[model samples]
Target: MRLLLVTLVCLVGLAPALASDLLIVTEEFPPYNYQEDGKAKGMSVEVVEAVLDEIGEEAEFVFYPWARSYLTAQNRKNTLIFSIGRIPEREDLFDWVGVIAPFNTSFYKLASNGAIEIGTLDDAKHYSVGVSVKDVIYQYLKGQNFTNLKVVGEDILNIRKLAHGRLDLIAFDEASFAHRVAQEELEPLLFRQVYRLEDLSGDLYMAFNKDSDPDLVERFRSGLRTIKENGRYDEILMRYQLMN
Candidate 1:
């Protein structure tokens, strides 16, 4: 009985350490959540980090491709995902912490490509469009029956494809286009937004796997609310120009 009691005490002591093992996961969706110089940095990342600090918690951020990050956050316990599009299709998949940033998705084309035009969503079907695999935009467009999509694992590829005239248009968020453009050394004036996906233009969020501890999730939610009240959240957004 004494041995069993000691074992129980040890397990109880380890609980706090285990609880702090939150895996912060995200993809390279810039100005919002991205990695730089081996450290996590960006608007949404800062917001999440502030929440962690406000609540006196710490975690490691892992950067992956969108599909891998999405899958890990969807199925792994204690994994927190950020800058994820909170769509109806994903409403019940995870326990949402709160909105962390505003997201704006759009279809962009080469400014010089005056020959191709998209008057309606359906008009985009007539030409080849490039999309990143498992991105929210790709999922939404795929559901809407867009067969002309050229799927790629990385969104940065789409930028090159459209630039080289291999794709008529590429779907991207406004911030991502600008970030990738600068990262790729492409001229910003060369691309233009042909259409804004107003439906996907909404709040990005941080969420935990559905099976996460209710208390932990609630604590994070409270931390987020506290930071927003204390103005840290707004400062991060203003820095990124995501003020909405």
Candidate 2:
């Protein structure tokens, strides 16, 4: 009887650890995952939490700067990064799941700046453009040898630089840019969507580390699918006003 009792205790003690473990890395980018009042709260956080709950999985998220988050995703075992742009160069680095949102990579110019007419990448070559440092967009532009491009450390500064006439153009995700503009009430910084680069349409996904357990990935995929099928996915998107 004592042996049976000991066995039961061991099983109970190990049950929690046996649950699927997920480590999430994120950055403070609004409308996605960001810190609010000292707590992590945003669309991506809520959606991921819901999915984990559905799968009966355990998850812990660490928010860092964009560069740090990206590095963490690349190096950490059993980890995932949220709302990462699905780029070809990064295709084989990690397992992908649940495309959360699609972003239009557009060029924004000052409303009064009539000299700039961006129909293609070449059209904006003469003007200095600002992009977020270490972002995929910056890498893409740099690869193309686009001259006169400036990279800022943070996304907010790109818009500010554009507003101050320090940058002739700015390349960024349209939804995120709009969210920042409205939230910050930057009405004077008139930005126009000059060129929509379909080639750079960013599809956001949850990227799991290459060394993560396959079962955990499968569970997350299943949970995501379940949420989408049951309309919880749409609800979460709507909750953040991301979906109309």
How does residue 105 of candidate 2 score in lDDT? 82
TM-score for candidate 1, residues paired by index: 0.90
What's the lDDT for residue 218 in model 1?
Answer: 98
| Best-fitting candidate, scored by TM-score | 1
Q: Model 1, 1-244: lDDT tens per residue?
A: 0100001112111122235567777777778877676666788888887888888877767777777778878777888888888877788999999999987888999999998888889988898999988878888898889999899988889999988989999989888789899999999989989998888898889999899888889999999999999998888888788787
- Per-candidate local distance difference test: 0.82, 0.76
Judging by lDDT against the true structure, name the best candidate. 1
Reference-based lDDT, residue 37, model 1: 61
At residue 39, candidate 1 shows an lDDT of 66
RMSD of each: 8.1, 8.7
